[model samples]
Target: MTPTDPFPRVFIGFDPREDVAVNVLTDSMQRHASAPVQIAQIRLSQLRSVYTRPHNPLQSTEFSFSRFLVPWLCGYEGWALFIDADMLCLGDLAELWALRDDRYAVQVVKHQHDCESGTKFQGMPQTPYRRKNWSSVMLFNCGRCKALTPQVVNTASGLELHQFQWLEDGEIGELPPQWNVLVGVQDVPEDARILHYTLGGPWFDDCQTMPRSELWTQARQALNHPLALQASS
Candidate 1:
């Protein structure tokens, strides 16, 4: 948590199909966040009017444009964090939250990841693109992201946002890759802060065993455990 605020606002991309996955990620974050956490879902249906540009459905997922709406949703005020719902938090988010730098428009795990190959969850084709996983976990310097207004997010070309063409190189700051450990694409470090099931997770029948799948499986197991529920109550 920041010194001035007791509750941090976090927004996660939401897709109806991934409700359970989102819940696990939320539970993991709340368990570790030091202060009370406020989590909001970014839904495309609600953001449609905000986008003023054409979008290509073939190349998009449920979360494709939602991530870009963080600053707008916050009314371009104080800082806010946006993370994909597929993530599993392993460390206190306050740590990630504290890394915010006001100089840049956004701070992300600057992964030089090649676009993912092979099939994605439920057989979604994995297409490669620049700045591949960079937007998965972000600390939006909302005040600096003024250009990413509702109209821009609604209509900007996918490449402009995903490739980060929206901002100059200096405007982007790098975060430790551990904050977004890509399960299959990269090696998991001893102190990974978050585990991202970029491809798929155990919840899907086809992805019951991706790299670090055990972590997610264990998280779900903990969520389902009666003892865990009793403890929370």
Candidate 2:
């Protein structure tokens, strides 16, 4: 079936205290938008392990939400687009929404970053998914994702919620770039629909080239609200 047949809904993971993320996600759901978007705050407990505790400082809080992606989407009715806060839905999502199929859990390919840090992330490998991990902006089949989350999250070394790189460590099917594209990192073929805030992000990861991003605009607007997170959170 084509994406136009029955558009897929968009779903993004939201950590609490991120009103800016919430605002942008809700705003992206405009009727003129390409498709529907849903936000799910991850809820889970932590399991202690070696790769999780001794080495990874952010371990306790990181992987807890990592494995929840598939489970969260599975709870939904059909196909969905999963992206981080660093993206904006510029074009109609109807095309992406239609990628869900029973055969495989679709996602974009992971390209290695040019920077030393990105390349360095490539060095430490343990999970089955790290072999060719793609960017976080994934368009996937919720049903497929559900079937695979257990295997992905329950690896021998377990999951590592790393902060610096493209891709989550999971065995997901490949979706076309039209579904999820990274602007700065990925070549961003002219026909590509979405723009991933790759190098610099909206909230201030690496602000070298991230200027006038749609997310930044939404972030500014969110801070104007009565209960908003400040710059120094």
Candidate 3:
């Protein structure tokens, strides 16, 4: 979890409903990463002991609030990346990992997302708030993010956490928007490194037609068809 850490540690939010999404995402990351990466899924069911907060009605995904636990999970030391399950890596993750900055407590793609209020995948309400999708992807400088203890994460209001009230404004660094291109929400960019299916993904019947969904389908196909190994003398 430090600069000396052998591989970049990535913690992905996991929701049981989108199990396939996480699998495909992992496959995409593994295929594109220039070096080995350590990935973990943050499942609420597995953290019953540490995260005991009652579910909030507005919670869209199981990892809504649990995403804040990334720093604490890293033992409040080193650097790590946290991303939503509904994402695909189109470019090498090593490129994204190289952008980590130590000056900020956390780095994210600062988005001014003003999407209309409506329902998203699986009938989830699309609520709007300040710094809406920023938390969806994070590069945590865990050493500087000591403020996010387990108690703070579990007890803090959604706004306080999502808006990053735990740290000063200057401490919140920014990443390029292309790293978290929102499908159907943000304009499709030719160099989008990570495609975020924040609204929904092709895995769901209704979201099958989302922009660049074919890319996700292709990744899934690649996941299912592993390269065959040839026998050697």
* Best of the candidates, TM-score: 3
Across residues 1-233, which tens digit of lDDT does each residue of candidate 1 receive? 34544456799998777788899999999988887788998887777766444546444358877689898888888888899888899988878877877788899988887874656888877878788888888888888888887777777777788878888999999998889999887888989989998888777888887888888878887887564445555
**RMSD (Cα, Å) of model 3:** 2.9
Candidate 3 off by > 4 Å: 226-233
- For all predicted structures, in order, the TM-scores are 0.89, 0.58, 0.94
Candidate 2 lDDT over 110-195, as tens digits, reads 55544333311112322323422353565655554443344344442333422212233344556666444555556656665555
- Give the backbone clash total of model 1: 5
Considering summed lDDT, which 10 consecutive residues are worst modelled in model 1? Answer: 51-60
Candidates 1 and 3 compared: the better one by TM-score is 3
Candidate 1 wrongly placed segments (more than 4 Å): 1-6, 48-55, 116-118, 225-233
Error of 1 at 33 (Å): 1.6
Per-candidate Cα lDDT values, in order, are 0.82, 0.47, 0.91
lDDT of 3 at 30: 92
